[model samples]
Target: MATATFHQSIVSFASPSSTISQCGFKIDSSLSFTSKKINFCKIKAMASVSYNNTLLSPSKTIPDNTLKKPNEAALILIRHGESLWNEKNLFTGCVDVPLTEKGVEEAIEAGKRISNIPVDVIFTSSLIRAQMTAMLAMIQHRRKKVPIILHDESEQAKTWSQVFSDETKNQSIPVIPAWQLNERMYGELQGLNKQETAERYGKQQVHEWRRSYDIPPPKGESLEMCAERAVAYFQDNIEPKLAAGKNVMIAAHGNSLRSIIMYLDKLTCQEVISLELSTGIPLLYIFKEGKFMKRGSPVGPTEAGVYAYTKRLAQYRQKLEEDSEVICS
Candidate 1:
């Protein structure tokens, strides 16, 4: 077999001093094919005025009661676990599908990976697969806080689902389901097998259909079109929570996530073309002082420097391990 070599694209910065903290999340970084370093751009800092896209202007003042401790701001993004379509090598797109057995296991494992992190809010696409991933991952959270889906569909629904006691509300995380966070519409390819599609269309054509930034697949959404909605939702809904210093976890599909990542990392059309994500893996970001610092996922209990940013994560990890040992014993 011929050995295949791969290259890691590095995002370029004007200078080393240009930390993500100083610049708004809209990074001025560009991908360099020859570079081996991994570069990340933060989401453009929130502004008083909305950008040309669907972003709405943030409130000028946060209520005194709304201010959380600065260190509490964190963000976690996870692509949902494998679905039946994924197991069958089909393009899932926006079709509402359930997880496969392997996907259920993946969701459980994903929960363990971020068991120590604090999650004050949850966001997911209004699809079963994404919803299942978020709920299953929360199973191992050290906080042991239950996740309650918020039902704000109507005044009646809201009133019916309201918790009478404040204590109960405080103990649970709100999981908000939104269609804007759903996966890219895969159009006519929704149930088709990937191999067959590639066979029908040439491999290169299929690759372009799958990976190109602006080219949509046979009436499906292109990455650019997906970003118009996904990133907009993040700016409008998710970022406000982070701006208020709340830790948020978003469970969504691959293309939707890639769209948000493109905004956060400031990937250009060419750069985002090759971006890919693995299912059930959570990526972390630290939000403080109105900026986001990308912290790659924690792969193990003792991964050095991973826990240094948050004291709560380290303490929770220790407690989780002790609890696990007790269960085994």
Candidate 2:
């Protein structure tokens, strides 16, 4: 196996003088993509990714500058792109519509905005639109790690799909599809046209059904009802993963995400009603010290604010860029 060792980190986030002692992570000094083994494998258990997208080992070295926040983890939330029903102005609810062509593009675009971010695990709703969005977005990630849908319905299914190779498993990201994260059930209004429904039910009544925090549409769920389940799932499933230092990404519906955002941002019922999220945009949050701090949406990878918000992200970006340059050199 071909290999190279660096006594010093040739790639630095800001300075050219970074040495091995200053960098806690293991990085092979020069690139030989054809190398049978890579430095990424050395820290695979801790970094949770391979060299396809990141230059660092799975156990990413934490820079001393951000040493105070060792438990910091990234949290990304993206609503699914426009679905076919969305294009038709229909009440999709939990109907399971696929994305429109425009929706596909939106997903790709959202992926670019957060392409630099490292995601350890992904969670998507049990609906196809959300699943599609998550899959498409990952295609744009710098790390070419595969996102595998974990099937645990039966022991046989789980055993049959196992990747026996340690390197292969470390390079894969687990995608968990959960019914609890599905969009709020619209009940009787699931397939109805939004405009027609409003006219049939009177504008005032329809407005209340759609926007009121506690009111339901016919037999459908209210925003409050959605929150009861969505937020509970967030706390029980997603939050603990972040608290454990795992970077996470969630792709779901507008209402489901809105409900979670309500909990994260501590939005009032009235305030959440006024909050708006465009389809396919990714919102970034930092989880540290048992609290979530909103970092807002990243416009693109070129946006300095997003990458520079933390030293780890900057180092991650710099390392990958250097890897690309070494290959081309």
Candidate 3:
């Protein structure tokens, strides 16, 4: 409910100035109390005093000039918005699914949320949904002149922009497609509906498949496996950005993001499984000296906005059900 209210207020800030001016608030309070009772007339009497104080204040604003823009040692992790598989409650695994119409809208809104932030580099998986979300976000930043730089295996660190300058006039923003960043491979569970999988494999087993760190689904990867690749890639590719003082954004899947979060937050495998990532929401991280310094809360339309969107989705689902019932009748 609080999130819903927040989302509603956030959505109203359509203008850049309004969005930047929005203030955050908090309340604090303290209390102390004591009591003494005497029984019978002969008993001695005691006195006690108590004091309480409370302070509530709006979040302090850091002047744009005074506030240090996040250093180049920053990373934004965003789960690609809902895909067709997500709508069907199917296991997407490593399968590439296109974003549904609503998913596209979510990505657009997410893009608008961080349009003003200076993002120097963008990272994405080979999957289309993640790639599309990254592209939409980049477009929102009005970086149309930046050309995508593709990294290939044979050349390893080949800078595609330099090579393709003659082919395309636009200055390319380097786009590095890496397999290490791909979503957890679901293996045999990839195409199965969640309910069906639960029924066939039993709920507990299915839950383990979905939530366990070391337990791979059939022939698929465990969270640990995903993290291994993700961390490796992060160190090899993403670490350089931070060292160079560049802000980076990574668009990927829930599992992949979880992998990175696990490393950054120092969460155990079990804990990582419990972490939730909302689609299209950005998780910003700041690093210093090859270590995490801080992480920014997801900045997006308020919970109210997400609730509104969810409600609309529910209504659409209900209408489809009703239509199907009518046809059956």
* Among all candidates shown, the one with the greatest TM-score: 1
Off by over 4 Å in 1: 1-72, 308-329
- Ranking of predictions according to TM-score: 1, 2, 3
Q: Which parts of model 2 are misplaced by more than 4 Å? A: 1-69, 307-329
- What is the lDDT for 2 in model 2? 8
Model 1 weakest 10-residue run by lDDT: 13-22
lDDT of 3 by residue, 1-329 (tens): 22223223221211000000000111010000001111111110110010001011211323132212433245677788778888788888677778888779878877877665556678898788888888877777644545374756555456442464553533455677776788877667777888887898899998898888777777666676666567667766886565555667899888878777665544444445566667777665565444443333335523233212245434433443343222100
TM-score of each: 0.74, 0.73, 0.65
- Which portions of model 3 miss their true places by more than 4 Å? 1-72, 142-171, 298-329
Cα deviation of 93, candidate 1, in Å = 0.7
> What RMSD does each model have against the real structure?
13.8, 19.5, 19.4
The deviation in Å at residue 232 for candidate 2 is 0.8
**What TM-score does candidate 2 reach?**
0.73
lDDT tens digits by residue: candidate 1, 89-126 = 88877777788898899888888888877788899988
